[model samples]
Target: MAYPWKSWDRALFSQVAGRHWPGAEPVLPRLSRAADHGRLWGAVAAGMAVVGGPEARRAALRGAGSLALASLTVNTVGKGAFRRARPLLEAVPVIRRLRRQPVTSSFPSGHSASAAAFATGAALESAGWGALLAPVAASVAFSRVYTGVHYPSDVLVGCALGVGAAFAVRAVLPPAPGVPRPGPAVPVPELPGGRGLHVVVNAASGPPPLLSPPAARIAAALPLAEVSECTEDDDLAEQLEKAASLAAGQRGALGVCGGDGTVRLAAAVALRHGLPLAVFPGGTRNHFAADLGLRGVEDTAAAVLERRGARVDVAGTTALDGGARGAAEPFLNTFSIGSYPDLVRVRERWSRRVGAWPASVLAAVHVLRTCRPVDIEINGRPRSVWLLFAGNCRYSSVGLAPVRRRDLADGRLDVRIVDGGPYARTRLLGAALTGVLTRSPVYEAAEVRRLRVRVPGEGVHLACDGEVAPAPRELLLDKVPDGLVVYRGRR
Candidate 1:
């Protein structure tokens, strides 16, 4: 049962164990133990999530996912397939050995695999983070041999497996593309220290919390900028309108710090007044800001000071009956109806009390239990649907939910519909869970320049950019190409 590589692996393990290095007794063993069961990497991921921007958050999530995949594969398949024995510790230094040794097969090192997977996954999303984590990962891999627990070949194979797992995770959930090229750069005033910039701050926005209040950060970064705070008692749209008017008179840029809803309102006003917009992401899940590559207040401030700007498309809804409520109203992110509007309603109702993530979970459960289909006309064809989603641009998704968009100014609507039928909900959920929702008969996804939707009954509520409003029975959803000009740093 002696393998040809066994002698070489043994000899290498002896060499590593027999060597004496400076400062090796106290640190390496403790580091190895700290990495047991993926604790070290988990702590690193948490730190990145708390302190880093959108890219950092994405890197942390991707790294954690990849680690999980690698660990699962190593334990369930790799180890069982090759039940190699652990290396003999006769030539090992007692001080460097782990207090509690691993009991699994030693053909592939689980710790090494997890480290490689996390580092590779994070690097794939963000090179800067990857560069930082690579050394830690390498150290952990080398520790396996230094502790006299695994052969070098085992560590190498484990790293290879880990890398493969990270790539597999990427294939399932691809990272968003890098900063898009500036779209037809528009001329804008370079405001130093945010002079001539008027910004309205929504004090009630944001989730997961920031290190400091956005207003304070903006004030510190751009001292000369005129900042106004809007509270619950204040009317948001009205305040934005007033700020836009003021900025217009001063020949300055209008700025908004809030969620997608607040940004959407500011955009409408900026477009009306022919003023460029600056967006500071101060909201829960700053989807629009992240897509625009504005990671924080500093990014938008830099863009404004440097006069870096571009034009992006905006989508809106108009009532065929000429109702004021839906007359040429613009939305920056998504518009949806049916069960989804109900979800948004429920989420908003409880978000203030329980927070956004918990509220979403509660709303999802509530919708799944009590929500029903709505009768509507799609392009003059009668249909019953559980949900209808229209995105400003074509979105990427693995299932029924629209995740993110690859292009902002695609000049098209990404429309997805869930047809109502017998066991429609069950079928839809099953398909989504199985990653076959796109192929399911009840699900339909397409991209178009315009969409016409009609409600057969009384007024239906429409949700745009997380804001819910009443809509006329007959409605048209279409894109306004190159509609809003906003500051975005060039890549």
Candidate 2:
């Protein structure tokens, strides 16, 4: 069948080349040559990593991924289907012709495809980065025609394909978060001898300290406060709800003497009833408590009595796979997928035998040795990741210990992703042992208000606030600005 568009395509090519200026003749060829084998795009990605901030690094990585997809599609499918021949050599100037031309069909220009893909993908992540790259992408696309390798129609089609591929890739990745608005700061109410206070203690959470008859100690400290204990068979959510109800009726604050998961529950209840929450460092790790600089139950209790506290943002997740039972769960510290769940499982299994710190190290080694990257879609782009973590706020490295969030009210989620590249086990082990996992090349971090994680298969393991849960096929994570009012002793 004769295609009518072919004639018009060739005519357009002829007109573009006929109007080409002499000044561009010297520059276009160099740009075209630089893009050979997609080396220029790789260089751009590397440069962004070295010089750009967190957002820039993320954009660079996404751009590289999109470029790869565009190049593959153009070379394998678009070129093969059209089988169009390159422009005639006699139609171009001798000086403008490439020394070694591409030996593939020329219906769609590969260079143009890659350029458009990178620019479009980067822009979708960060408009500033995209704006910076747009001119460069356009120049590279024009270079193909200026160098007399690809015709105008070929470059045009290739660019269109590239842009389409970028959007298609982004569709699979998690969507970017919205702008955060500062939440209203709620004042902390004083608790004289815990007169209007309610506390729930989960016996099964963390070490013996959290479980060490918390009701007795709490009663001794706050004689007038109501205290509830969750037995092994008791539903934690129910216990928390009951405590919240009591606090609402008594006009008091709700407190949790347990781990991160318990703290998360208390935060949710506090938010729902507009009550302040007191977090006791009763968990083995007590990530949230540590972030708040709370040493133990006594310090938390003292903070409550003094009415000293801060309103902080909370991280919330909605399971897309019907697993959450139609409710968004709040997390106070960090939420993770991939190898992290494995590590936590291993740690729990061996902590009794070898202590918490040693068990953690062993768990790291064990998980790293057997861990494989998870196949996930972020926003809408497919990615294979060894670990993906989102902290409630920005976490800065503090020596050999775990990361600590410096600001709880920043209203952003600190997302860190570790790419599962070749020999991932060895790389991860080395980074962990060297205490440089957070700074490794395989690691990428960004601050976002919202992110979506989707798994191709069912039963994605997720670790939220040190507790494991089976997440549905998709999960939407977002930051709730000043979502919880918590008591913290003045520093």
Which number leads on lDDT? 1
**How does residue 374 of candidate 2 score in lDDT?**
89
Query: Which of the numbered candidates is closest to the native, going by highest TM-score?
Result: 1
Q: What is the lDDT of residue 415 in candidate 2?
A: 89
- Tens digit of lDDT per residue, candidate 2, span 343-420? 988998999998888999899889857878888998999988888888888766422123565577888888888878
Q: Mind giving the per-residue lDDT tens digits that candidate 1 earns over 166-246? A: 998986788888665435778987788898899999997876454878888898889999999999899998999998888
lDDT of each: 0.88, 0.80
Model 1 misplaced regions, further than 4 Å: 1-30, 46-54, 72-96, 104-109, 145-161, 189-195, 207-212, 321-326, 361-372, 396-399, 422-437, 457-460
What residue pairs are clashing in model 1?
Answer: none
Q: Give the worst 10-residue stretch by lDDT in candidate 2.
A: 174-183
| Candidate 1 all-Cα RMSD | 4.2
